[model samples]
Target: MINKRLTFCHENWSLREPFRISRGVKTCADVIHVAINCDQVTGQGESVPYARYGETTESVLDQIEEVLPEVEGGTNPEELLELLPAGAARNAVDCALWDLMARWQGRSVPELFGLEVQRELETAITIGLDTPEKMAKKARMNRRAPLLKVKLDQENILDRVRAVRIQAPESRIILDPNESWNMDILRLVDEELAGLGIDLLEQPLPAGQDDGLREYRPKVPVCADESCHTSQDLPALTGKYQYINIKLDKTGGLTEAVRLRELALGQGFGLMVGCMVATSLSMAPAILLCSGADFIDLDGPWWMAKDREDGFNIQNGIIRNISGNLWGGTEKAEAAVS
Candidate 1:
């Protein structure tokens, strides 16, 4: 049996700018960092508290504390599934275990999971909900990026899309309403958004209120973010959502996230790997899931004022390589030239 020192801490990272969704606005990212010290090697992971899921920093910390005894007594990642419900707390502990196990076995997490570590990935930069001119300015700044994820709310839907489209004419656009739209709003934007060169629409209506999507199909592929969390969600999301966004924070960790991806693929759902505004520690493990994703939204760290040491290399819109020793392997992975 292996004994490990399990510990968790809460850290708040100030975002470079305020990020807004359908729910609210946030100026900082409150994250829980978990570390497992086994023998001589130490592994680390991070999870951002998501209010949309009714999660708070204090609540997640308590959840980790509840399972500390078992975690320190050599409970592996697989066993953690039964111990905690899928959420931010379990995600931190599970990823920490995976990181520790990878180092102990002398293999990277991707290699251990039988995945080829992606060398270059095109990730969508997020433009938070704001005034049309402001959002358009943000889009103009990132016009060189290959993909831009525009955050929308109930108001300024068309204005936001039109402004961003004019500013970043060549960039592929995706809309993430974050469950702020109703049937009327969806009906209102249908014709215009279809011609706005948008590639995807995410969570237009509130979860459980999205049954209307079954009868209405828009020109752009619609994705599920707040609605789909685990593999169990794939069944109900069949006709409603053409794509599903996979975030480790939502699925608990990479263990379940990988499982969700396989099941999602089996169900003919397009996969999009996303992340919250956390650190490199959180985003490191998620990079492996972007292998064949139709859209990648791992720009959480880009919104931070400063990220953890040796973060992923992002140039324009492309994420070139995973940096640092956050996950498996050495401090630096061989990066392709940008």
Candidate 2:
């Protein structure tokens, strides 16, 4: 006789505060959290939409429901891989299996994936889109983080950087325009930012317009985010971007992310391991990519009003697992989630 199957569910989460960027976001987030329960173990994953990318949690949850029958009927994660293409659904299932397997077998998921545990990492604190003054204030507050990822738009770009630089004069800085930049603004600000001690500039040009970058000369190194999704995006970015920001959600999950890393590095591209707004579980898998990354910007959960009970602890720009469960902290997490 076959054993009883597990339970599955997905829900929405709201950010404690609106996370503003160059585009327009002024309120709570509609996040999707996927949970899988089996026996005494449970695994969870989170997914967020990039409206610019045309994704929504409702659509993602609907996609999961479409596959609910198969998931309930003992379809394994490996099977889910072939049945479903990479996206939020496959990512949730893949990570849920990683968690379940780790718990049921008393092994750590990273170990299963052949990744070593990192004791410490210097993450880039995100300076949300704001006035030059407010952005600088945020940057000043986290000056000790060693690195800062400044979010910007086409408007008042110089003013914002000037303010932030005054406060965190010595902090290594990088800029993420999120494809809000055009050739005019990009070329216009390159010299100012390069002079301001900005080490790298991220996604200065729009995704489809990256072809223009071929003839362009950057004042600083340009890392690809929106322009670099899967490994297939690598060839197109050649000679255009010096680095690629690898987010698990964008690549689908940890499995494909690893493959994308190898392909990008082999083709001579730098790497930045990033994340959507997610709890530690989702960020943990991306840490592997950080092993060789030039920059680490995994500050997704920091914006949460109340992180999951057993979530990661952020202190002075470093992340540490508190519960010590196979995936993260369980005692603290279980007590909170339970």
Candidate 3:
């Protein structure tokens, strides 16, 4: 037991603009930020409660508050896996623990895991769900981005994707319906998706409705977002999804995310590292898992009105690593603590 203290608070970050998906719209990102201080070093983590996963901001805060005693008493991150179920609450506490451990060991999580941190991670800039014309204008503005994730719904799916494809002709597109599409819509747009140069289609149909994908093959690779969580989901996702979007919030933090990635790869599923709208504190841990991922959507901070100081830099479409004790990197952590 290293001398430790646990503290948490809820933060609400107003987005520069409202971000919309099929389920709802968010004008701000509400997250729980947890900081663990072991000795003199303080490490931070953040988790956004997703309504899709049955979590609200208040519920997440309450969940963390419930475990304060155990966390302060010296519960390690590995032990945390047994404490909470996989969701936003566990994600906040688990990552905080990882951050604390990294600071204590004087190593970044990636270095601790013997993984090379990729200097530049190419991330897909998201164009949230909106009218085709508005979405197209947004796409044109980000034309320099190499990849564009176009959020869609049941209505005007082809028009929106086509509009973005036309505006950003060079960008590889990922169409994320966010479980708003049906088999008919998928069938209707099957051929056009490949023509529109959509490299990946994410969570087209609602969960449990995905069994249709077992036999219904399409030209574009379909990635699972809503359908997959941890390694336990691999069996159900097998033969249905070609890719799995891994988010720390969904996997209960980097611990399970790393495990899920290894298991997913062994099962022959392509990997994608993603994030909800969050700050760099949340994105930092996910960056460690970005190695060899087929797609990276950790651009949550890009949509924010402001970001933490020393946050990751986005030059063109490439997200460069940050140099600070934001979450990882021992030298930076030491500098921050000292």
Candidate 2: worst-modelled 10 consecutive residues by lDDT: 329-338
Q: Per-candidate TM vs. native?
A: 0.96, 0.89, 0.96
Q: How accurate locally is residue 321 in candidate 3, as Cα lDDT from 0 to 100? A: 56
**Clashes in predicted model 3:** 0
Per-candidate local distance difference test? 0.87, 0.74, 0.86
Off by over 4 Å in 3: 332-338
lDDT of 3 by residue, 1-338 (tens): 66778889999898989999888999998989998887788878899999888998899988888888899898877888888889999998888887777777776766666655666788999999999999999999999999889999999888898899999999988999999888888988989889877899999999999888999888899999989988999999988999999999999988899999889988899989899998888898887677779899989888789988777787557897555457775755433322
Estimate, for each residue in 160-232, the C-alpha lDDT of model 1 and write its tens digit. 9999999999999999998888988888888889899899998888999999999887877889998999999
Off by over 4 Å in 2: 1-16, 73-78, 322-338
Better of 1 and 2 by lDDT: 1
C-alpha RMSD by candidate, in order = 2.2, 3.9, 2.5
Model 2 per-residue lDDT tens digits across residues 140-179: 7898878888988888988988898888887888888888
Q: Clashing residue pairs, candidate 2?
A: 132-160, 323-329, 324-329
lDDT of 1 at 109: 76
